[model samples]
Target: MRRADEKDDDHVTELVSRAEQALDELIKDIEALVRLESPSSDLDALRRSADLVTEIGTRYLGVGPERIEIDGRPHLAWRLGDGPRRVIVLAHHDTVWPVGSWGDDPWSLVDGVIRGPGCFDMITGILQAMLGIRLLVEDGVDVDGLTLLVTADEEIGSPTSRALIESEAQGCTAAFVLEASGPGGALKTERKGTSNYFVNVVGRAAHAGLEPEKGVNAGVELAHQVLAINTLGDPDLGTTVTPTVLSAGTTTNTVPAKARISVDVRVRTIDEQQRVDEDFGRLHAVLPGAVLEVEGGPNRPPLQASASQDLFARAQELAAAAGLDALESIAVGGASDGNFTAGVGIPTLDGLGAVGGGAHADDEHVIVDRIPGRTALLAILIKDQLSA
Candidate 1:
């Protein structure tokens, strides 16, 4: 294999060394960040996570409060290596786990696993990107335009942070999302298009025990709609539709007057996005008495990496040079902030954080052993991008 040129060789070696030395501090910072439990709906917790990130940014990242913003939301931005070809790291500090959903204390490193609410969804990602950048700078990789855009609402579709990600991404040439990598080791190059849909069934309520014929039975109608949604799923193409959230009925005796369902959808291609939309529309026809509403249509768009996305290829080379295994970039079923950046026509990579399983579950955790190596890969990726 050909070695990196003189500049590339020295920078890669130096960044790997610095990242190795910084791993302990990175893990500690990640543990503290996970303590905040920044669920997407909890503005306070998300903001607090952002604050914790910014504080760590100040102490270790060498950026001041002026570079940080925390009014209704928390954010941090920095410039590394001057020029037009800029690079940005965009990630959210939020998770799907709700408050009180986990154990009494959700933060701990048990047997090399950092177990917590937001540890897997992305607080760990923030730590990786933040600390990675710090190591990059400390290793003599002078970054004049290395910007980090850490936002609050990625787990719940990034309603508030989407605009910021797009705008920040526009200012850079490429972006990296701090989402967790594959189970062991890999980079995510593509993610399914997403849509969050809702269907409401409206009917007349009557006592099930007394006047059963007088009721329209919204709950029964909802079942029909749910079946229609299930038909949209095609396992062969990675497209899925699940009416995962349902709400209806007030009492056992009375027929449900109103029912609501929220669906989680994933599609492989842009064309399939339209198919999902058409299938969602069929929900209205399923129950004449029901009303349906659709929301959140493909917020991230597919990552869809081609050879044109040279950034991903460059990242692989850099990772290998840092003494890590060659990264196999693959498509993922989950979404990330990288989706937003890529939607805006920028080459983006996701899953650059800790390696672990159980995201959005009570058992969510980060594999402790993978932190340093992943951090090393990130540092090298940044250095390689700046100089590539």
Candidate 2:
């Protein structure tokens, strides 16, 4: 006569063992996806990648996902089980690495470490979701009301898939994001919101050595605006406003008539976003003859910590039951599709993917040994959420 908690622990152990046995299959699937480079900017590569994802998903779940195409890009979705409580799993198949960026060897597994483009960023996460569902079905768990979305354009700000993601997340009990784990496999409980702006200045041009007084000097005005934008960030409050790109003057001697500045903004709260937006709107040209135009605004809202509190707690308990390392949570500065889900007032827990470093860099890789534990943790979390 085992206690309820003990029984739960045994169940988790069984699931973990199952995942361990499937490790080779998981690596094979990851290798296949890594071999096909699907950069966000490449449509043809995205199509091929989507096809491979579909094939792998169908093999695992015994069903094919509905291919949703927007702007010639393919996003895949699957609606599984049926119940009152529902959950949406958010993932993206697109990577930051372009085709041929991996050099000659696209996929490599060395000493239990797999390295390739998109392997850590998200491709492995997509397969992990599929495998988690498969594991649940094999164990005869009633996984009702589970939806998985694999978008094609998340790396490029989800230009084509934001609306669809929101729609899928509506009325869900929880949203689990598989965007890779944080440092040391920690879960991302919160993420900063992102905003982008481009400041364009126009002014009268004149010969610098001759009629300098007749020119408004847009370059000078741009400098003033950059200094003003720098004041918006409050480090204590986790707000950052950075002028990333700047361009002014066409030649060394010419009185430049045009200048542009690209600003990057991140905030931990909606109020900060509003404050920054209002301040940017109030910007005016310092030069009397110069005119300023601001473009772009708040992109993805923040993933507030409150939205993930409950889900993350459950994940920790489930991780312990699964006999894995103690779980930790982090608040990252980067934004993900989880931000959109949390923005819609749904409870979302992110960073439930692979345990690896170098997300978008040349050394991107995944630890082969940790795959089973991570997959098992996801499986148990989903099972518990659905049951609840």
lDDT of each: 0.73, 0.91
Off by over 4 Å in 1: 1-11, 65-73, 79-85, 99-104, 286-296, 307-309
What is candidate 1's lDDT per residue for 1-388, written digit by digit as tens? Answer: 6564656666656655666677778777777876667776676886677677778877877765333434455655655445664788877666788777776777878888888887877777777787777776666677777777777667667676678778777856668777888767677877877878877778888999989888888888888877777888888878888889899899989989888888888877777878788766655645555555555455657666651258777877666555566777767788777877877888787788778878777778888777767777777777656766
Lowest lDDT 10-mer window, candidate 2?
Answer: 78-87
Worst 10 residues of 1 by lDDT: 64-73
- Report the lDDT tens digits of candidate 2 across residue range 1-388: 8789888888878877888898889889899989989999999999999999999999998889999999999999988855553889999999999899989778999998989999999989998888988999898888778998999999978889999999988889899999999999999999999999999999888999998999989899999999999999999999999999999999888899999999999999999999999999999999898999999999999999999999998888777765788999999999999999999999999999999989999999998888877888888888877877
Model 1 alpha-carbon miss at residue 9, Å = 4.3
